[model samples]
Structure formats: C-alpha cells, structure tokens
Target chain A: MVPDDDTQTADERWLCAVLQRQGLEVEPARLAELARAQALLARYTEFLRQASPVSVRHLGQPHDA
Target chain B: MMPEADGDTPGLAQAARALRAGSLSSLELTRHCLARIAELDPGLNAFVTLTEERALAAARQADEELRAGHRRGPLHGIPLGLKDVIDLAGVPTSGQSSQLHGHVPMRNAAAVDRLEQAGAVLMGKLTTHEFAFGPPRWGPPGPPARNPWHAAHFAGGSSSGAAVAVASGMLLGALGSDSAGSVRSPAALCGVAGFKPTRARIDLRGSLPLAPSLDCLGPLARSVEDCALLYRALAQPGEDFWRADELPWGEIRGLKIGVVRSFLDERSGTSAPTRTAIGDAIATFEALGCEVRDVSLPAPWEWNAAGMVILLGEAFAYHEHWLRSRPQHYGAGLRDALLLGATLSAADYCRAQEHRQALSSNLDALLEDVDLLLCPIQASAAPPLDQLTTWGFLEKPSYGIAFNLSDNPALSVCCGFGPQGLPLALQLVGRRNDEITPLRAGHAYEQACEWHRRRPPL
Candidate 1:
C-alpha cells in the first residue's frame, strides 16, 4: 500500500528544513536522504498494518510444541 | 585509608587505587569477578553471555602491560560488560531479539574498541530488551535480568543486565546506551552511576540503533568519577566536549541549579518514599551552596509525545525488514510497542519532529540561566519484576528523554534509598555537549553526601 502522498511530502519538506537549520548545506542530497528515511518508515507502517493479532506472551513462546 | 568492606562505600576511586598500587592484578580481579558472577549471577541473571575465557586472557594481558610499566590510565585493568547491543567482534550482538540471536559482528563497536585500548577487560555481553525498546518479560530463551538490590524486582531496560552486573560487582562497570532513559532508568533502579553523554560525544559506529538521532553510548559504574573515567576513554581523544580535566569540583559555591519542580514535583504517581528522598536531595543540594530555583518544563506531555513519535519512526525503520520477513521472532511486548510506531503516519512523525525542535529550543533557553537541572530519574524505585505491564512506558514522566531531545548530557546519581530500601536517584542534566560540569557537580556531591558510600546488600 502506498503512503498518503501529502503526508510523505510534508515529512520530506520538514526533514529538509531541519537539515538546513542544522547548517548541513542541505539541497537535493538532503531531499534524497529524507525520501529514503520516509520510505523505510512507510514500509514499516504497512508491516504493522498487516501483522496478525499476536499476544505479547505468544510472540516468543512455543505454542504447539 | 583501608578499603571499605561494604562494597557500596568503596566507590570507583577505591577500585582505581587498588589497581594502581599493585594490590590487585587485573587477572586476580577478573577471577574474583568471574567467581562473583558464578555465585550471584545465578540469582540476578545479569549476563546473556559470560566471556570467562576472553576475560581471563585479557586480564592476563592487562597484568603483563602493568608490570611492563605500560599503564593505560585509571580504567587500566578494569573489567567491564557491554550491553548486548554494543558489538564486540566475534560475540553475538543480539538486540535480545530471537531474529538476531546468532548475529555477530566482524569488528568491535567504536566504544568497545576505545575501552579495550584503555586496558579494560571485556567480561561478557550483558542482557538488554528486544531492540532496546521493551521491558524484561518472563519465559524467555533466557531469564530476565533482575535488580541486584532485590532479586525479584525489575532491572530497568533496555540496559537491564549492564546495570545489574555493575551493581552486583560482577563487573566493575558496563557500557549502556540511552535513547529514552534506557541507561539512567536501569542505573537508578540498580544503584549505579550511569552517564548518558551528550549525543555524538562517543562514536555510534558498529552499535545497534534504537533511534539513530537519540541513542548515546555511555558507562554505568558505581560512581560518577568512574563514569567520567570511562567517558574520557570512550569519547574521541582531543575532542573539546569530553573536558573533565577543566572542571573544578567542590567549587559548586556559586552554581545556579534549576530544580525543575513542575514535572518532577508533579503528582505523577511517584511513591511517597521516592518523593521524600528527592525532597531530601534538594535540601542537601541547597545546604551544599547551590542556588536552587523552580523551573518550568515545556508541558510534560508535549515533550513525551514528540519523543515517542520520533523514536517509533526511527525504530520502525530499522526493524521493518525483519518485521516483514519474520514477524513471529520478536517478543510480544516489543512487537506491540514497535507496532505503535508503524501506525504513526508520516504527518505524525513530522509534527513530532517539529515539536522536538520547539522543545529543544525551549529547554536550551530554560537552561541558559542555570548551570544544571535536577529531577528524579524515574518516578519510583524498581517495581516488582512480574508487575510491569506491557504499556509501562506510557505511564511515567520520563525525566531522561527531555535531555535526549536537547542532545545534552544527563547523568543518574544514586541519591538515597526508597521505602523498599531500593536505590533512589536524581537526574543531573547539563548543557549540550557539556558533560564536564555535570560530572564535576556529581563527583562533588558524591564526595559530600554519604549516599554513594552505601551499597545494596546483595
């Protein structure tokens, strides 16, 4: 599933702004970094959405052993 | 003076003295420590892997170097433990996750290399929470590391084993990372001195990430001076930030201390004993010539919410691949807790980042007039091991994370004992990259107060 376009764009802009403020000479390179970070975040968000309803106890323990 | 028979009274100063005077060889010290671990660790579960063979070999090398007049300074020949997340070459740098159980690194983390170069013997890999994000839960591939003060109580995570090992004398000191109170919380509960140096003071290379922006590697020891010794070694040599030599201790006569009473004094469900102990510590600080004034925090919830959003976003980025490929390998609490990060929209994360910038600005302004800020490390002492809930993180006012957001140095110094007789501590926060001032103040206070002289009856 694709992340909401508006939210991703906003995140990218915010990250670029932060980098610029930190005086890191942000430009297109900073935008690329933001894009990569956001993509990773988006992927994980989706993974959470698809995860089964597993209890905290059942996550690590053997069930049918 | 003779060394204090009570382990608590003999701080790191005594240990260093013993090493320097040839009263204790590093090899003998290592054997004594291994024996302690074999005896007490069965009850405490402080180590995930005890490197007995490596420890002995390193100890032998340390002894040879000392005899050859090749001293490495105060931490020379000292034995220390690395939290499982800090990679030591050839050891499994498990994030305590089953998914990464067999994961080993080809090189030591920067901090570990620094410690080794300082002549510190690596005792073993200590336990941590799954990815350094969750509490210790029972029924694991291993037992939960328990508090040394009370075997049944929790050793706060995700630096759980590191704190326990240091407090129990199984190791002289240990390395721990702090993202959101992971270092100080456990150090506070376990009656040890834990330092969270200013962000980036020590290199994070080869260390596992909880939040890349916030994680800091520091030492957990029995005294502030020991923490300072380890900090000086781990920090990049010649870096201006690790300037402990310039700090003048016992000169706190004109220091301005911000009490930070709003969040600290707020009725955040802290136990009465903890409240009383903190009250006494403030009075003690006042008596020691510090100018104490109440300071306001940037609305407690705002700081926490901002930290939570950023932390989750960052942590999820690291765990995403594994969460997809092997969802069942993570522990229950950690999986659910990390899942919350998954639900954070990009907008939410950005808003959190914006809030973080504002909070950092506000906190810096608040500290402009004060040399240091003081608060309770945790709201209370160690809770029972079995009583901690899945959502325990949401329930407390995290005094440690506020500094993490500001990228400042924060230390946990054991102040006194709570009602249950477990250790109670106060958080000392300094300006960005200014660890010297806090270390000096903490060292001076430790000298004046008898608190650091007391040890848990293990």
Candidate 2:
C-alpha cells in the first residue's frame, strides 16, 4: 500500500505532465509526486472503464435528504 | 458544580447530571462548547460548519422549558456534532465532495431528527473523507482533519472529524457512519470509544450512502457509557434487538470468549507494543473468570474481497453520473476509488452479495458457543501524516469490517498505548442484534482498567 521509491518518482513525473498540460508554469521537482498520483488515477479510471457496469442500485434516489 | 479544568468543561455524564440538577443552564453549556470549538477547531479542523445562531437559539429554548418544569432527558440541551454525510435542515450535506458543495437539504436525516427530538442541540457539521471512500489528501476544498494527539498524525477516516471533535473535547459526542472501519478506525487512533451497531438497529433513511448494504450510523464518544446513551436515543422503537442497560451483567461472569489468534498475530507491521497490549487484555479477561478459547473462521481475505466488491459496486452506482460528468472536481484519491467502483459488473456485485450471505452464516456458526469474539482494532498505532495513502483501507483485515459484512455489532475501546504514546485498541464483537453483550463487556473492562481515564496530552 505504501508507494515505493521508483513508483513515487513516476507519480511525481505524472503530476508534472498534468501541470504542463494545464498550461500552469511549474517546477518539475516541485510537482513530481503529484504527477505520479495523476497517472495512478488514470490507471484506475481505465480499470473502471473495462471492469464496471452501466448501472447498479438506488440509482434514482436522492442520496441527501 | 465541579470547577472546570479550563472553565465549566465537563465530561458527557457530568454535563447531563448538572443539567438535570439545574446547576448548569443549557445556554451556559452551549456557549462553553461554542467557545471551545472556536478556540480548538482551527488547529484540529474538526468542524466544517458551525451553527452558532441555531444552536444558541435552541439552547435558550431548552433553558426556558427547563425553567417552566418541562424537561426532555440526558441529551436535552447537550451540544453534539453531526458528521457531514448526515442531513440537517437548511444545511449543505456535501458528503465531503466538491461536486455537491452547494447542495442543501430541506429536512434532517432520520437519525438527526431523532436526536433533535430528544433535545440535543446541533453544534455543527464535522468533516468526512471524499464521499466516505478515500483517504485524506491535504489540498481539498478544505484541509484534512488532524489528530488532536499529534497534529502530524492522521485521525483515521472517513469519520475523521467526528473522532477529532469528540477527542479534543470540542463536542461531547458526535455521530459517525461506518462502511468499512470509518467509525472504529478513527476512534481507535484518536483514543476514544466507537460503536458500530447492528446494521438494521438504526434506520439509514436520510444519510448519504457509501455502500447501502454495509453503511451504518453510530456514535463516537469519550466512554462506553456515552456511546450506550447515544445508542438509546438513536435506536428505533421496535428495531433494536439488544439493550445494554437491560442486560444482566452477572450472566457474563463465566461466559466463553473466542480468541481469533491467527487474525491478530499473523499480520506483519504489527508493533511489539500493540501485541503486548492485546496479550494483557486477554489475560485480564481470563483473570475475570471468563473462559478463553481459540477459534478459527473463514480466511480474513475472503471477507475483505467480498466487502470490496459490494462496496465498490454500490458506491459506483451512486457516483457514475458525477464520474462521467464532473470527475475533475473530486480529489485524486476519491477519483481513483470511484473508478474502481465503476469497474465492478453486475455479476461481480451479485456474486459478492451471495458470498455475503454465506459469510454471515459462517460467522453465526462460529459464534454459536462463544459469547464474544476479540481482536486488535488496527495493525499498528497511528501512522505519520505524510505516509497516509489511498490503499490504506485495503492493506489489512480491518478487525471491524467482517462484522459489518455480517451486519453484527462491534465496539472498539482503548486497550493501551504503544511505545510512541499513540493509542491501541481492542475490538469486541457480539452476535447480530445482540449489541448489549459487547457494550457490557467493554463497560466492565473500562471500570477495571485505566485506559479510558487517560486523555491525549494535547
């Protein structure tokens, strides 16, 4: 569960890429971890796209009163 | 009246007693709690919204009623915090998500309505994880709630702020929802008492859903007695199958207790101090004349997997539209979790559902001869703040989750502290609808031990 050193570095790089894509000026070192985090997110989302269903339960009910 | 440590600050029981004796007015107690929240909450991040105007007005009304000789009960005029996921009229029930930040409600959730009817003043809304599924990430719509013991450690979640508010004495008692270990984890880490009642014991009519099948509402407080009191107020008239106050204590004098040794001992990363504390707790039970027997049930991971499938499927069902539309509004941790939920198919969900029934039946058979089951609440003491991650909930058996899968009641109380002075806890679970036995067991232990009497150095 604890992200390893190389994985942490990759996550940092991913965050940098996201920032660059967003057109925000940033230091690569400053957002390195955030970059890897975004990449991990992309992986999970892709997993959902292939694994999840179109609908489940209580779909029409309002969650909040 | 007892002189206040800071000023007029009393534990929940003492506050109830003072209110009954007319020695303390509701307005005075409400003002004191408000002042405490103002002074401490900035450092703790326990509260998301402070209802000063409504709370003060309610307290004044309670005082007038008391002066006119009409009184409610223990909770009358008492100030309490509601976790943000629970609804309150005219307040935003954000579920700790940016997607629903401005969404307000027209009426209170059923649990809140019951508490308010019992005369408990609503002080504010407490923080929760993003939609009650992920770990804390600092750069949110607001800061993640910090542990009162040490600001550098986590307070556990997704009931993060409920535990902090009660632990710091900002609120005597607060409501928290547990889907996996949300309530118990935070309570254990923050050094307090948390009760996850039987799933059907309290209605989930108006609260935000994490996993409908596993979600439960309960209380986190300074003592088992306070949790019991809150349980009494929230328990439905004919629904709750167990009553702690009505249970005969002497009946448990020679009851047999099942010790799931492998579950507690097999895990890595468990600290020596936690092991010693758990060992001491078992010895205490043996010394109290109870029969302790070793028992084995289903593999812990089986239950973990079953819980994940059901939880993810249910949560994704709730958030699919939002995920499809405003995905970027969610924090990275939550966004990934919902994506995981999104991946579960109907067959996966149904298989998990069928597995849940089998699991519950298996657990029931295991509990046939044992009066209670005992285990450790967490793998280790609270981790440092920066080390918290999205996979934290998936890394262990979550001594509390299997019971949730089985819809059984579980209670967590401080057993002892680790070498670093962080709290360690023991979990006691009772049969379905039989919450009283565990509560009584906890109360007996609390009376004999010093753990509940100690507070964090903060």
Candidate 3:
C-alpha cells in the first residue's frame, strides 16, 4: 500500500528527490509501485548493513568472485 | 519423414543418431520444428523471430557437409534457438522491448559464433523479459511466453521463451542469459533442464547486459545430456572445457550431496508437493549409492538481500542512460525495476558486495565437504501468470540467488510432478568451474526417473 504524501518515510522522500534531481519522472499512477520498491530496498539494504559486516575493499573487479 | 506432430519430439541425442544413421535429414528435422512452432507458438509466444529461410539454408549446408564426411561436432545440424537478448547478426535482438525495435547487430554474439562454428542450425530468436529485468509486461513486442504445462501459469523469466520453446518441442535446445536465476527458473517451471555455467566460463560478447557482474549465458534443453552438449560447445577454451568430456557418466556413486533445505521456509511459501518431490529426489540419489546429508547455508533472506542490492546497482549502471532518455519506451515493470536501482546508495552497493564475497567464502568452505549441493528451484509449481508482480521476488527468498552470487555452476532438472501436475524441480550446484559433477549427477537422476520423459499436454 502506498503511504499518503503526509505519511511518506525518509527513504521514500529520498527516492523522490533522487528521481527529481536526475530528471527522471515517475508517473503519478506509479507512485504506489515506486513506494513499494522503496520499502523493499530499505528492508534489504538494512539487512545487508546489519548482517555480518564484512570489511570489503572496493577493488575494481567485475563480479563477486 | 517428419516425426508425428503430436508425438514426442526427438532430443538432440536422438536427432544426432538419426542424422548420422541416414534415417533422418536435417531439413526434415528443421521443417518439423518449424511446423511445431507454427502450430503452438501462437499460445506460447515463444519466438520473436522465425528465420525459416535461413534455418533451411543452414540445415541443407549441414547435410551437404555431413555427406562429405566432414562433421563439425555433436551439435552439427541440430536446431537451437537463441534468447533475443543474445545478438544474431542482421536480426533484431530486441530483448522484447520497443526501445530496441529496429536495432540489429552486424555480428553474432560470441556464443552464437561458436554454435554456428559447430554447425548448429539457428532456429530463430526466443522471447525474454524486456532487458531481462523483470516480469513480462503487456507491450508492443509480444505477449509473455506462456508455460507449456499450463498456459494460464507463469513460464518463469527472463528466459521464459527459451525454456518454453524447448519444452514444447519447438526447438530441441536454446541459449539463455542468466542473471539472478533467469535461465533456471524458467527451465524448472517449463519442466526442462537449464544450466548456468560458472561466470566468465562463456564469453559474453554480443549479448545485451543486465547486470554484467551477474550475467552468464547458459543453455536450456529437454535433458541433462543435451545441456552438457550445449555447454561443451559454448564454454571458453580452457582445461575446464576439455575436462567436461571426462565426466563419469552413470558413475555418480560415492558422491557426497549436501541438502540445503533452509533455502525455503513458510515465508517463501514452499508447497507440500514441492517438499515431497525434493524428499523423493534425495532418496533416489541415496539409492544411486550417493551419500546424502543435510547442510546449512547463510539464511536465504540475507543472501537474497545482498544479491538484490548488487543486481539492482549493476543493472542500473547499464540501463541508466536508457532509463533517463527513453523512459517512455520501457514497460512500467522494467521502468519501476530500473528506478529502484537509483534509490540505492553507493554504501548499500558496497555492503552488498562485501556480503557477496563473504557468502562466496562460506559456500566455498561448504563445498570442500560435498560433491554437490541440492535444493528446490522454486517454492512451488508455476503460479498463475496473472499473479506475478514486478516486486514479488523481493518478498520471497530465491533459491537461485546464492549460486549466482557465488558464481557456481547450477543446474535445474525435473524431479517430480506437483499436485497441480506442473513439474517440480531440484537444483544441483557444483563447485565453480566444475559443472561436470552437477551435469553427471543430473544425468544420473534423469536416467533413473520418468519425469523428463513425460511431455506437457500443450
């Protein structure tokens, strides 16, 4: 379910700003869809940050291994 | 003479024998495939291009070469379809998107070049999700490929058409790109065999990029032996390539198999039939004289989280330009998926990468004790096509993600049927660059079962 504008979370707000700054348009009808994506991204990214915080060197490798 | 239209289509192995025995001609086989496509593709939407004249010309050439006793290899004169995401010279590699409606490459993808060099007949291009990013959307290029087992169900993507074509007898085998389970999911759902080789084992030149970090080209076919044949032909030249022939066929005894049942849970919505199917497959492996034991991996949600972050980040890198300039051309599902990538921070992507490296290490440690890892490719049988949503994968952990994250060779083969009669699949994962073990294991299982012999009612 899409949160109304007044109920937008910080990530949703950030996502809106990112798209606007990049000059990318999200159709009004798709706001609910985009909000759902934002919620998923937030859930997963938080899990990554908290799960086994491995120190990674950002070497320019194409893939994980 | 052509095989009966409604009868079982000969697999590549059978076709090769018939061709060599002078009992079946390449033209006859190609014509039969073309006829099958003409009859069934209307409902399946499996092909984006037919290439009838070109396929016929190539079949005749293969016949002439064979008559002169100059066989190229096992694939010579066999019919194969390419997922449209992989380029075929002068033919539009649409990737099922309007943005590339008129774009045609002048060179075949490196794998395509290799297949042709082996004298394989090019049947045409198969369907894929738009840019291979998300669920198929209703759009200009064509309807999504429907499951051969039941048209109302999902075929699984983004390699939907490749699996559907092979399962329905429209093509004996086909090439597909796997990034985040694209090839295996469809193959599992369509009740065929799909193999995703270790990353970088096959040259990626000339194929459209999804997440280059995760993208690998693989084959979908009716049986494990057919997948092995195609993999041998597509893999880059190396010691690994030659070692493929050394696979001890029917000798999987004494092999150690690790079962990862934690990959599914109530949250993943695994069906009872799927669980039973996998349980039965484990028993079959044990009866074949293999040692089976339960093992654990990092939680599926943890691996799933890291995979999605990296996949979205890398995919957005490839698609940012198109997503920005021609946003109108993309289907809403693809657009939404690509946009999600924009919302990710560099920190998030880096963390995901860290998780990937750590997970790879964990998997490597696990593999040191086992010959192969086993799991279910899907939690259940193919769901109704209408039930699929672009964001649904995020909620359910995927069985195919950990292999992609670790770059291991993973093969999905049919194990049994579900209560709904759709196919239930089991995945066999081998150590990186060691696809031979999984292929051998899958081949043994296929030989012991009747699942692959059953045809879809379509």
Model 1: TM-score, first chain: 0.35
Off by over 4 Å in 3: A1-12, A52-65, B4-6, B242-248, B264-268
- Lowest lDDT sum, 10 consecutive residues, model 1 chain B, at B1-10
Docking class of 3: medium
Ranked candidates, highest lDDT first: 3, 2, 1
lDDT per residue for candidate 3 within B1-458, as digits (tens), equals 45544566789877877777777788889988998999999999999998999999999999999888888877888999999999999889998998887999999999999999999999999989999876787778988999999999999999999999999999999999998899999999999999999998889999999888889999999999889888988988767554432434768889999998687545556788888888899999999999999888887778789899999999888888988888889888888888889888898998898889999999999899999999888888999988886787688878888899999999999999887789989999999989889998999999999699889997
DockQ of each: 0.02, 0.05, 0.59
Scored against the true structure, residue B155 in model 2 reaches a CA lDDT of 89
The digit string of per-residue lDDT tens for model 1 on B45-77 reads 888888889989998998888888888877787
For candidate 2, write residues B1-458 as lDDT tens digits: 53256563576767877888899888888888888788888998998888999999999998888888777777888889988999999988877778777989999999999899888889989988888776786665667798888889988888889999888888889999999878998999999999999987777888999998899999988888788778878877644444422432443578778987756775534567878898898888887777988887665656666787778778878877776667778877776666555444566677677667777887799889898998777777888889876565555556667888998889989999887788899888899888888888887877778697776776
Of candidate 3 chain B, the 10-residue stretch with the lowest lDDT total is: B239-248
> How high is the lDDT of residue B23 in model 1?
77
Q: How many pairs in model 1 have backbone atoms within 3 A of each other, for residues 3 or more apart or on separate chains, i.e. clashes?
A: 1
